[model samples]
Target: MDYRVAPAVRIAGRCRVPGDKSISHRAVMLAALAQGESRFDGFLAGADTLATAAAFRAMGVAIDGPQDGSVRVQGVGLHGLQPPAGALDMGNAGTGMRLLAGLLAGQRFGVTLTGDESLSRRPMARVIGPLRQMGADLAAEEGDTPPLVLRPVAQLRGIDYALPMASAQVKSCLLLAGLYAQGQTCVTEPAPTRDHTERMLAAFGWPVTRQRGRVCITGGRGSLQATQFSIPGDISSAAFPLVAAVIAAQGEVLIEGVGVNPTRTGILDILRAMGADITLLNPRDAGAEPVADIRVRASRLRGIAVPPELVPLAIDEFPAIAVAAACAQGQTLITGAAELRVKESDRIAAIASGLGMLGITVETLPDGLRIEGGQFRGGTVDSHGDHRIAMAFSLAALRAPEPVRIRDCVNVGTSFPGYTVLMRGLGLEIEEA
Candidate 1:
C-alpha cells in the first residue's frame, strides 16, 4: 500500500499506541514456556507478534485471544514443546526468528525457521556463533541468513560471552537458551541496550542479574511460573506523533502509557537535546516497566550533534529523528550507527534516498546520514519495504510544502498496524492509495 500525507497546520489529540513490540514478543514466548496459564494485557496484535503466537501453537501450546488488549497463553513446560510439523514462518520479525532460534536450540527435536524476503536477508551469524559455542547443533543458509536449521542438542554448556555490538536480541536469545542450558550463562554488552528481556524474565518469575554492562542467568534450575501482567505502550510507536507534534505548525499531543525505560529513551533524550518541548507526566509503574504520559507541543527545534553514546538507545527512532532534523534549524549529524545498514532495509541509504526525494539536503555516509534542516517539499519516495521509513516520511509531510506520497508501505503492519488511522486522527491528511 502507498500512503499520501498532506501538510497540516496543527495536530491535537490524546492517543495510545500499541504495546511495545519487544515486550509483546517476550511476553508470549516466556508465557508459552511457563507450565500454566498466563494472562497478558495490551498484547500487540501485529503480524510479527502473531507469528510468534502461531509458532507456539504449532509446538502444542494453546494461545487464545490477542483480542482487544488481552491474550491467554497455556504454556507447555520448558521440556514439553513438540517438534513443529513443518517450517516455522516468522514473517517480517527479526526479533521473533532470532529469539525463537535460541529458545528452540535445546529442544530434543529439530526445527527449521524461515521468514519473508527481508528477514531472510538479515545476518543470523551473530546468534549462530554464540549458540554453537553453547554447543547447539545449528546450520544456516550459505550467507548465514534465514532458513536456519536447529537440530537437537543433548546438552548446552554455559559460557561467559561478550557482545561485539549492543544488541538486545542477541542478549535475549542467549538468555532464553540459557534457561535450558547447564551451568551459568553470562552476556556482557559493549553498551546498554533495551532491558525488556531481563524485565520480562523477572516478571515471569525467572530471576536475572545485571551488573555494569553484563547480564547473567543461571540455567537448569527452577521452572518459570505463570503470571498475569500488562504491557506498557511502545515508545517507538509514540516517536512518530511526538516528532509530528514537535514539527507541526501548532499542536499538542498527549501520548498515554508509553514505556520510558531509561535504556530505550534515547529518542526522548536526543529530542530534548535538540530543544523539543517534551514533558513526561503522571509517571507510574506498569508491571515491571515504567509508564508515563508524554506531552509534546510544537517548538522551534534547533539541530544539534546527537551524542554518539546514545546511538544504540535511539537506533530505532533515527528515521523519525531524521524527519525532525529535516524541519529543524541548521544541520543534524548522526554517527556511530553503522548497524542501520543491516536492518530490514539498508536504512542508512534508504533514509538518505527517501529524504533526498523529498528535496531535503541529505548526504549518505558509510555508517550514517548527514541531514540539513530546512523545508520539505512534496514528492514520491519509496519505503524499501521498511516500516520506519514509510512512517518517517509520512510525518515529514507535516512540514512539506505539498502532499508527500510514500510507496511500498504495506510493511508498516509489521510494526505499527493502523498507523495511517492514528495519523489521520491527529488532524493530518493521510490515505491509502
Candidate 2:
C-alpha cells in the first residue's frame, strides 16, 4: 500500500489510539498460559498482536475475539499446551518470536519459529544465547538471525544474567522463561528498559523483585491466575499524531488514555526537550501501568542534542522524533541509538534516507542520525516495509510543501492498523493508493 500525504493547514481533534502494542502482546501470552479464561479490554487489534494470538491458538490455547479491543483467551495452563502441528509463523513480529522462544523453551515439545523476510533477517542470537545458557536446546540461522529452532528440554535452570544492552524484549523473554525454571532467575539491565513483563507478571499474581536496574523472579513457585484488565492506548502509536500536532500550523489535539509508564515516556521527554507544547491531563493508573491524556498544540520547535540516557527509553519512537527534528529550527544530533539499526527495518538508515528524499538535510551516523532542521519538500520515499517509518513519513506530510508519497506502507497494519484513517480524521489529508 502507498500513502500520498498532502500538507495540512490544521490538525485538530481528540483521538484515542489503539491499545499499547507491547502490553497487548504480553497480555495474550500471559493469558494463554493461565489456568482459565482471561479477558482483556482495550487490547490492540494490530496484525502483530494478532500473530501472537494465532500462534497461541495453534498451541491449543483457545483465543477468541480481538474484535473491538476485546479478547478472551482460554488458557491451557502452565503444562497443558499441546504441541503445535507445524512451525509457528510469527509474521513480522520480532517481539512475538523472541518472547515466544522463552515461553516455548520450557515446554515439553520442541517447536520451530519462522517469519517473513523482514523478521527472518532480524538477529535472534540475543534471545538464543540466553535461552541456551539456561539449558534450552536452541539454534538460530548462520548469521544469528531468525528461523529459530528449539528442541524441548527436560528442565530449564534459572541463572543470573546481565544484558549486554538494554532491551525490553530480551528481559521479558528471560523473565517469562523464569516462570518454568527451577531456581530464581535474575536479569540485570545496564539501563532501565520497559517493565511490561514485570508489571504484567505481578498483575497476574506472580511476585517480581526490582532493585535499581536488576529484576529477579523465582520460577515454579506459583500459578498465574487468569484475570481481567484494560490496556491503555499505545503512546508509540500516538507519537505520529502527537508530532503532527506539534508541527501543525494550527489547533490542538487531545490523545486520551495513553500509557505514560515512566520507562516508556522517552519520546515525551525528548519532545519536551525540543520545546514541544505538551501537557498531561487526568493522570491515573490502569492497574500497575500509568495512564494519562496527552494534549499537544502547535508550537515552534527547536532541535536539541537528545540525551544518551533517554535513548533506550524512546528507542521505538526515534522514527517519529526524527520527523519532528526535521521540522525544528536547528540541528538535532541523535546518538546512543545503535539499537535502531536492528529493528523491523534499519530505522536510522531508513529515516535518514526517507528524510533526505523529502529534501531534509539528514546525515546518517553509524549510531544515529544528524538532522538539520529545515522545511520539508514533499517527494517520493520508501518505508522499507517498516510500520514506524511509514507512519513517521506520513507525519512529515503535515509540514511538507507538497504531497509526500510513501511506499511499502502496507506493513503499517503490523502495529497501528487504522493509522491513516485516524490521521485523516484529525484533518490531515492522506489518501491511500
Candidate 3:
C-alpha cells in the first residue's frame, strides 16, 4: 500500500513503541525449543515476529497468540522438534532464516526453509558456511540464496567459526547450531553485533559462556528450563518516533521500554553527536538485556562523520540515520556499510534515489552514501517495498516543503504494524494513498 505524509509542524508527546524485534524472534525460537511451557511478556505482536512464531508452530511446536499482548510457547527441547507439516516460510525476516538454520542443523528431521522474493535474494552463505562446518546438510542455490533444504544430521558436532563480517544474525545462527553440536561450539565476532541471542540464551539457563571477544556454547545440554521472559520494546521500531520528535519544530517524545543494548544504540549516539536531546531514563536490566524509557526533544542538529566501529550497533537504523543526516547542517558521509546492499532493498540506491527525488543532495557510492543536508523540496518517493526506507522518508516528510508520497507502506507492517496510526497519533499528517 502507499502512504501520503505531509510536513509535520511539531510533535511533543510520549509513546511506547513495540517490543524488540530481535529479542521477540529469539524468544519464540528459544521457547519453542524449551522443554515446557514458556511465557513471554511484552512480546512484539508485529508481523515479522509473528511470522517467527507461526514458523515455529508449523514445525509442530505449541505457540499461542497475544492473549493480552503476551504469548505462550511450548518448548520441545534441542532434539525434540517435530518435522514441519510443510515448507517453512519466514516471509521477510532474515533473522528467522539465520537463527532457525542453527536449530534445524541438529534436528533429526530435515526441513526446508524459504521466504518471500525479498528474503530469497539475501545472501545466506554467511550462515550456511558456518552451519555446514558443523556438519549440517544445508543446500542452496549457486548464489547462496535461500530455499535452503536442511537435511537431518542426527547430531551436529561443534567447531569454532569466525565471521568475515560482523553480523549478529550469522553469530546467532552458529550459536543456535551449537545448541545441538556434540561439543563446544564457539563463534567469534570481529566487532560486537546485537547480543540478544546470547543474552536470551543465558536467561534460559543454557550453558552460555563468554570470553574476551568470543562466545562459546555447548550442545547436547540435557534440557533447557522453561521460564517467563519479558520482551523489551524494540529500539529499531522506536527509531521513527524518536527521529520524528527530533526533527519536528517543538516536539519532545518519551518512548517507554525500548531495548538499550549498547551494541545496538548507535542511532542514539549518532543523534547525540548531531546535537539531539536524547536521554535514557529508567534504565534497568531485563533478562540481562538493558531496557529503558527514551526521552528525545527537538534540537538544531549538526552533522558529524559516522565511524565504522559504531556500524554494527546501528546497522538497522541507517535508513533513519540518513533522514537524520539530511536534516543536519553539514555533509554526512557513511562508509563501510556495504552490508546495506543486501537488505530488504538495495538501500543505498533506494535511499539515495528516494531522497534525491525529494530534491535532497545524495551521492550514491558502491558501499555507502554521501548526503549534503539542505532544503528538501517535497516530492514523491518509492520505498522499493523496504520497511526501513519507507519509515525513513516518512520521518523526513515532517520537514519536507510539501507532502511526501511513499509507495508500498504495506512492508511497514512487517516490522512496525499500525505505523500510519502511530505516526498520526504523534501528530503527523499521514494518509493512506
Candidate 4:
C-alpha cells in the first residue's frame, strides 16, 4: 500500500502509542516455553509479533486472541516444541528469525525459518556463527539470507562466545539456545545491546545472571511461572509523533505512558541534546519499566553532534532523527551505526536518498549519515518497506512546502497498527493511496 501526507498545521493531542515491539516479541516466545499459561496485555498486535505467535502455534503451542490486544500463550516445556511440519515463515521480522534461530538450534527436532522477499535478504551469519560454536547444526543461504535450516545439534553444548559486533538479537538468540544446552552458555559483548530479554526473562522467573560484562546462562530443567506481562509503549513508534511535535507548527502534544527504558531512550536524549522542547513528566514505574508522559512543543531545534555511544540506543530513531535534523538550525552528524545497513532496508542510504528527495541535504557516510538542518521542499519518497522511514517522512510532510508521498507503506502495519488514524487524530492529513 502507498500513503500520502500533506502539509498540515501542528499535530496536537494526548495519545497512547502501541506496545513496545521488542518486549512483545519476547513475551510471546518466552511464554511459549513456560510450563503454564502466560497471560499478557498490551501485546503489540503488529504483523511481526503476530508472526511469532503463529510460528509458536504451528509448533504445537497455543497463542489465542488479540481480540483486544490481549493474548494468552500456553507454553510447552523446554523440550516440548514440536518440529514444524514446514518452513517457518518469519515475515519481515529479523527479530523473530535471529532470536528463534538460537531457540530452535538446540531443539531435539529440526526446523527451517523462511520469510518474505525483504526478510529473505537480511544477513543471518551473526547468529549462525555463534549458534554453530555452541554445537548447533544450523546452515543458512550463501549470503546469510533466510532459508535457515536448523537441525538437531550433535550436542547442544554451552560455549562462551564474544560478539563480533553489537546486536541484541544475536546476543538473545544465543541466550535462548542456552536454555537447552548442557553446562553454561556465555555471551560477552564489547558494548551492551538492549537487555529486554534479560530483564523480561528475569521477570518471568528464570535464573539468568550477569557477571562483569558477560551474561551466563546455565542450562538445565527450566520452567517459567505463569505471570502477567504488560508491554511498555514503544519508543520507536512514538518517535514519529514526538518529532512531529518538535517540527510541527505550534503544537504541544503529550504521549502518555511511554516506555522510558534507558536502553530505548536514545531518541529522547538526542532530541533534548538538539535543544528540542521535550518534557518527561509523571514518571513512575510499572511492569518493571519506567513509564511517563512525554510532552513536546514545537521548538526551534538546532543540530548538535550526536555522540557515538547514543547510536545503539537511538539506532531505530535515526530515520526520524534525520527528519528532526532536516528542520534543525545546523549540521547533525550520526556515527557508529553501520548496523543500519542490515535493517529491512539499507537505512543509511534510504534515509539519505529519500530525505534528499524532500530537498533536505544529507551527506551519506560509510557507517553514518550527516543531515544539515534547514528548510525542506516536499516531494514523494520511498519507504523501502521500512516503517520508520515512512513515518519519519510524515513529520517532514507536516513541515514541507508540498505533500510527502510514501511508497510501500504496507510494512508500517508490522510496527504501528493504525498509521493513518493515529496521525489524523493528531490533526495531520494522512491517507492511504
Q: Which lDDT tens digits does candidate 2 get at residues 1-433? A: 9999888889999999999999999999999888788998999888899999999889998888988898999877888888999999999999999999999999999999999999999998889899889999988889988898889889999999999988999999999999999999999998888999999999888999999999999999978989999999999999988998999999899999999999999999999999999999999999779999999999999989999999999999999999999999999999989889999999999999999998999998899999999989989999999999999998888888789999999999988988888999999999999
Residue 294 displacement in candidate 2 (angstroms): 0.4
Q: How many residue pairs clash in each candidate?
A: 0, 0, 4, 0
| lDDT for each residue of candidate 1 in 1-433, tens digit (9 for 90 to 100) | 9998888899989999999999999999999999799998999999999999999999999999888979999988899899899999999999999999999998999999999999999999999999999999999999899999999979998989999988889999999999989999999999899999998888888879889999999998888899998999999899999999999999899999999999899999999999999999999998899999999999998888889889999889999999998888999999888889888899999999988898899998887888999888999999999999999998888888899999999989978998989989998899999
lDDT of the candidates, in the order given: 0.92, 0.93, 0.86, 0.87
Q: Which ten residues in a row have the lowest lDDT in candidate 1?
A: 362-371
Cα lDDT of candidate 2 equals: 0.93
Give a tens-digit lDDT track for model 3, residues 303-353. Answer: 778888887788899999899889899998888788888889999999999
Report clash pairs, candidate 4: none
Judged by whole-model lDDT over C-alpha atoms, candidate 1 comes out at 0.92
Candidate 1: segments with Cα more than 4 A from true spot: none
Looking at model 2, the pairs that clash are none
TM-score of each: 0.99, 0.99, 0.98, 0.98
The CA lDDT at 114 in model 2 is 93
Structure candidate 1, residue pairs in collision: none
